[model samples]
Target: MTKPTSETPAEDGAALLDDVERFHRRFNVFPHEAAYVAVALWDAHAHLLDCFDSTPRIAFLSPEPGSGKSRALEVVETLVPRPMLAVNARAAALFRSVSDPAGRPTILYDEIDTVFGPKAGDNEELRGFLNAGHRRSGVTYRCIGDGGNQTVQEFPSYSAVAVAGLGSLPDTILTRSVIIRMRRRARNEKVEPFRARVHEQQGNALRERLATWAKSVQDRVAGAWPEMPDGVTDRPADVWEPLLAVADAIGGDWPQRAREACVTLVKAAQVNDKGSLGIRLLTDLRDHVMVGIDRLPTVAILDRLNALDDAPWADLNGRPLDARRLSRMLGEYVTADGQPIASRNIKTAGSVLKGFYTEDLWDAWARYCPPPSASPLLPLPDGADTD
Candidate 1:
């Protein structure tokens, strides 16, 4: 999404209500996911007129084909101001535009991998732009002008971004994006109708409302910062800085909830990337920890964890269930409060594991593996082999 430079912090906002509410209502948008979109597109709206400053870029990805990624983008297209639909542009032209620091409108790309089709690393140029869009420092490049002049210009960078595609994007992009994983609706489930004109009217109203709100609370947005969330320890400043700013601006339960949601969702996606954990990861981790493992040998404990048909040990780490990751994941399963693993934390761990087990992955463990009791973290008793 592209933002114009004319917007001011104190400018009156007349857009949020219609755009945010409409998008929220029309689709079964996930709360965390919807917030990301709202904020990014909100920046786009501000840029269009003259309100707030930069914002995070958005990406919407899904596990497989037919996960409604394009449909999600349809909603974004209406809400975001001056969105650049990448798939519609010719690849060479798009890269050239992006290469120029002044690439305008929001750069919206669809079927990105496919769009960069049939060429040797054809998409590298485009990727560079998307990578930079997330951070001001990240958005710089040198392009030879029409007169064959070489100029190094830093492109305008803002949090205004959104992309949707199958599964996860590349790490360079993923690190910078607030991703929304699109889901496939079951045969029995459905959301209300959102045709083009209807979506447009609804989105326009939202934009107007949010813009109005921001105008009214411009001071609050700049000063109403809230308490920072815990466990943002390992996150990047680029990722958290704007996020915290948004929270500070909102200054209510939303600030805390939004930040926590970002941490949880981002981490879950990372864990899911590793392919080691699953819904079973949460259920099994709880089962194993509760059952106890103080006296159980590492091998026996491994056996039990692998035994869950719901959670496969081999899939945990493509190579094997190594001691390090296993121990780390177990340790991370609980928070400082020692509560059962929250669903979101489990998601983050699973995402992280998915990244590791990407290639040459072994199939899941055989069914009905045993559960473990408490342990003293003992070594294997004899020559007990895990494989």
Candidate 2:
């Protein structure tokens, strides 16, 4: 039977939502290397609106106070619809108003960290707002009681948000963000024009067109969400669920591509266990120890690992790395024939233990440690002349 066409409005909206790449190709222009980042942010923003509809994102770009972070946002403001630019001073009140039942705002806070970076108290203040807004939840607090005493009250609000900063933010913030690291601009490269359109009436018309189309396909955009891959099963159901919902509404290749994009983006911004102590690092350590496919005394292995005297980890403060540290670090990685080892410069039982390991770190850590050699032993000299 023919598959049913995505009949939902949200799904149709996903299908109708603007494909960012089209604009690039149409202009015969390729964004800088960070263009993929731009796409991810754009997709997140679209999903933000489609999901919460009124929840605005807080997108930030930071670089050493002057790597043109603000300038980048200038370009973004020019392109995005209904952009609300706010100085850090105005950010909290802007969010409070957005969270207010009367008029919720979608906001952009530029250089917000400066306000908090000065002291721990300031940091605490920003953290509260960030924690509260990172994912929309009902806000509750004490209100005045009927007897002129304080009373607790709480209310719900839907407000989508975004924030950007230099390097990285606190782990709490990172856990809930799509990070973009802004690099310093090159000497001779060019940046496109950035400005609010005044004379161009057509820009407004296009924005209206895009917004209109977005509103029309809301339901179908939601349907494709159920099919997203399993890796992200752990995230809160509130955030990406809606974003994926919008992606599914678009159906066909988009649902898959968008899913990939969503996962890739979030994963890129996150720090994983593999990244800090990955296979490469592990392999390098194993190589230093000279592990093979056999058994050896565990003490020998520790000795060899301790042999490192000048590796990066073992380097003394304010002193240069010495050769012993590097050697020691490498020694810790050595293993035996299917068993771990410390060193191999000695014999086991009646025979000399031969070479420590026949394979290198690259192969060993990929878990492809080589087999012991099977070459025939050399024969004794037949009849040497009397000395």
Candidate 3:
């Protein structure tokens, strides 16, 4: 209940974000501090969407119902500008909503798993819409009218979008998102009951404050090239850039906090990544199945991979990874000299057989996988140097 005395815009911005974070913590139990940080930044970012080149989708996903996924989106609804909450909305409707002339809306899509789930059976248009919307220049083309009058017209798909659902989304969408893996609240964990009639006003008040702050810093945010934490490059850099920029603009502990959240969440995503089976295979080969050996015959590799209790090699497509499949998968990768890591005939004992030399895989392993560390999968602790 204490009033904030800071008069400067930057100080006010930082204080406002802190208020947003606390509001979320009141009704929701995020898995980690990073999730809370990312979500708060995302809410503020939505008000300044035009100042950003890309808007990372904040996804709240859970493996089961009642994991607070929808509740997370509900909390988001109150904080963003022009919030449009949709469930089971058609692709065309979404397309029009984003392209509306008044202003692009912040899309809070719940039950997203249904649109991308097994039973959904390839909602390609919706997928494309979500993917394209990540970048500022993203757009969707549509044929207008009929017959001779028909012509393809481009509709702007760029907007701030957050989704919540049970299970996972497609890899394309997941890569563009700040994923929060929601979980069932523990017995000891308790949160205030959310009744929109009472709390919506509170959230909306915060939303207005955020909108004013965003206006005050719009130009600065638009031109910001915030320094990224070491090892955060490529797609992860692109994903965290805007949030980091917003943090920098707010000017407080937020800049440091945002980077920590970026590293922690990015590391968590890498650890739990289910998208790249090929990269997984390469890392497994380097760490587990093909260690300290110069050569491993295809049969031996297959046996080891299949024997792995935690790997998918044993039941890939209802059959263990065979020599042919192994060769096919490995052939997809190249060495430092730009040669495929394909099997070569190796003379073992008296017989020759197709196998991979460890030297051939060295380049691919180095480039594609993180170096072996004692706890590579663990999240970086707060204030830990990522360099």
Judging by lDDT against the true structure, name the best candidate.
Answer: 3
The candidate scoring highest on TM-score is 3
Error of 2 at 222 (Å): 4.6
Q: Estimate each model's TM-score.
A: 0.57, 0.54, 0.89
Model 2 has an lDDT value of: 0.46
Candidate 1, poorest ten consecutive residues by summed lDDT:
357-366
Q: Return whichever of 1 and 2 wins on TM-score.
A: 1
Give candidate 1 regions above 4 Å deviation.
1-22, 28-54, 88-104, 115-122, 145-159, 216-226, 234-237, 275-387
Q: 157-256 in candidate 2: lDDT tens per residue? A: 3444445455445545555554455556566545544334641243344444455555555555534445545666544233355655655554556556
lDDT of 1 by residue, 145-250 (tens): 6676767655444435567766556666666666666667777656777777766776765555444454555555555334445655433334555555544454
Give Cα distance to truth, residue 217, candidate 2, Å.
Answer: 1.9
Candidate ranking (TM-score, best to worst): 3, 1, 2
Each candidate's number of clashing pairs is 73, 57, 0
Q: Give model 3's clash tally.
A: 0
| TM-score: model 1 vs. ground truth | 0.57
Q: Give the C-alpha lDDT of model 1.
A: 0.50
